[model samples]
Target: MTKEQQAQLSQQGVEALDKLLKETVENRVLPATYFGVTGPEGELYYSCAGEKVFGKPEAGQVDPETTVQLFSMTKFVTSLAALQLVEQGKIAVDDPSVIEKHLPELWAQSIITGWTDDGEPQLVPRKNPLTLRHLLTHTSGLGYAFLRPDVLERYEKKEGLKGFLEANIGVEGYVRPLLFEPGTHYAYGTGVDWAGILVMRLTGQTLDEYFHEHIFGPLGIGKEEITFLPTEQVKERLQSMAARTSATKGHIILHPGWRNVAKMTPEMIGLQSGGAGMVGTLRAYLKFLAGILKCQQPGGIISPQTFELVFSDQMPEGKQPRKDLADFLEFMGVTDKQQTEGKVTHSLGLCYLANGSDDGPLPGSARWSGVAKTHYFVDPKAGIAAICGTNIMEEVPTQFLEVYSKFQRTVYDNLVQSKL
Candidate 1:
């Protein structure tokens, strides 16, 4: 089809997406939402609707350029940095002892079996040495406190462990022992954050600086467009994030306290969290995704060989997020019965979920999301990328997932219709 014809057809399908977004806001599913889809042949469409902050008229409407905290989505970039190092021969993912070269403290790491009857934290020797691959696959024993209550208690009771969220991601912060042996299972944790520290040690550059000099700068994204530290002007464009809460009477209510968790203060100025700690606009992040999708060809940031590693699965055979973990997530309302019933896996840098139907994206299509309700997916075989964002503090509630799923399905339906 002609380029003009392609654009016309894509626009037609976007109209359905546009209507769905409008209706979602009208129903108060979320205070605001921004989404973009770029694809198979470079077509693009995006929209923003509803108030920027729930019940805060002074905050104004969300726009295409507004920045939101990336939260866990930062993992993709951190993995990208490590993969680039692997591509350059500076690091090897398969080496079990690789992380020790940068962070020696891990050499003596132990696994937490549980507490003793006397109330002492019980520990055991690690069976297998930790590897860079283990960290990338989340098979390395690390975990987050929000998800692991044991870790939260450990962090709180540990002496001199202030700034747990703000600035404690150094050798001192690597205090938690392994939940299990390395490479045995998957638990989302600070493996990527340590990977970020490794990147800084290997390159002698900060994570933010390395991203700009290598990935963002090469793709024409302004240095200031996406950052861990937002300047005054960029800060103005940051939408206030809210935690989803039960409705008051008949109205949807949101708690804004979660916004503080994402803030970067002076104390945290130097700490770069590979697992979380990133902020960017939907437009800028989409550009990053486009670069990831395009870099497989010549003249891109990394060579095709390296790009393949990014999208391909790195998990060991039959090893993925533990079923019990999924059960706990379902209990906490983080995932539904359908999602927990199926296996959860991860690629080098993204989450590997099920394939779309015969008419949708390819079987290997990969995606991941941030804590504050931001999500993105790239279909390599179909040459399509779509992302949706909101500043809401937690995972999309089950009811909202219905809307998000519909939006995703609509995007694919439009892609198929355009082909016809």
Candidate 2:
């Protein structure tokens, strides 16, 4: 395509994305929503629609600057932090001794075999050692109790431990028994949380301190733009979390769980969860993603060789997605049918889409989403990164996925495929 044609396509793409955002808010699929795209140099597109608080027009308008809880999206940042240490020769991806020495609690976790006759969890010692690769790849056998009822739920309930969200104690809340043996199966759980703890143990700095000095500083991101604890001012720009009451009727209400979380003072939370505890503006996150995109070239945030590892498929044979993860992906409506059939694999930091979709991101792209339906993808081959941000507690509403998938298609159709 000629330069003029490319520019025209880009403009049309922006209009389509803007229309999608407005329609979702108007239709009440989400209270507020924003989408952004970035290239190696800087942001290419950004637009947001709807109010910060639904049905409260005077509250504020949602924009690129609005902060939203990043949830699992925080994992990408934490994974990068750990990878930096690895680059410095402070840690190794496949080495287990480093984790064993630093985070012994993780190393000591036993695999749950089966439940006893009386609802007790039967535990067995792990045959293989736990490695940082396992942690980053979600093959460490750790899982969230709420997601895995058979093992982790029974174990946490029997042990009288609080869930990560309910517990004031930080990483301790995530310390649970393994759902399976290490490096054997994929279970989306607290492995990144443990990896964050490992980073702290190795560096002797709090996760926040480490990030400010290393990750954010080098990327030229302001400390205020992204943080584990949002200040009162930062909180003011936060989009209110909403739940879809009726997708068909276009009804929504403030998400009660998120409302309680919004009420939490910084001091109320004890430790920074690397997996879920992050709040940031879309602009700041786009910069972070842009940095990852730049890493595909030389002398970026991380080495080119290291960046290759980030996209490389980390899963070996027999290490497939667990039932819980498969079910969750099905709910999200992003995965290909073949993904559940064992084609799914994880990269160092994100889910690897091996077979590029017809209407979405290309193959070899790494993608993941936050709990509140905040989604992002970094496509190195396409030389672009994009995010679809929303603050909603309902697990991947159908309408939201429709817009999300369409947004991806629009991005590629105009911004990427046009150039090709």
Please list the C-alpha lDDT of all candidates, in the order they appear: 0.71, 0.79
Candidate 2 — worst ten consecutive residues by lDDT sum? Answer: 1-10
Model 1 ranges off by over 4 Å = 1-9, 40-43, 158-160, 167-169, 246-254, 257-267, 319-339, 342-344, 354-360, 416-420
Which TM-score value belongs to model 2? 0.92
Relative to the true structure, candidate 1 has a C-alpha RMSD (angstroms) of 3.2
Q: In candidate 2, list every pair of residues with a backbone clash.
A: none
Task: State the displacement of the C-alpha of residue 385, model 1, in Å, after optimal TM-score superposition.
Answer: 0.7
**Structural similarity to truth (TM-score) of each candidate:** 0.89, 0.92
Please tell me which predicted candidate would have the highest TM-score against the true structure. Answer: 2
lDDT of candidate 2 over 262-375, digit per residue (tens):
677778777788998888897899999988887766777788988877897876446345444455577556556644554557888888777755556777887888878888
Tell me the tens digit of each residue's lDDT in model 1 across 231-258.
6667777777666554443345556543
How many Å off is the CA of 255 in candidate 1? 3.7
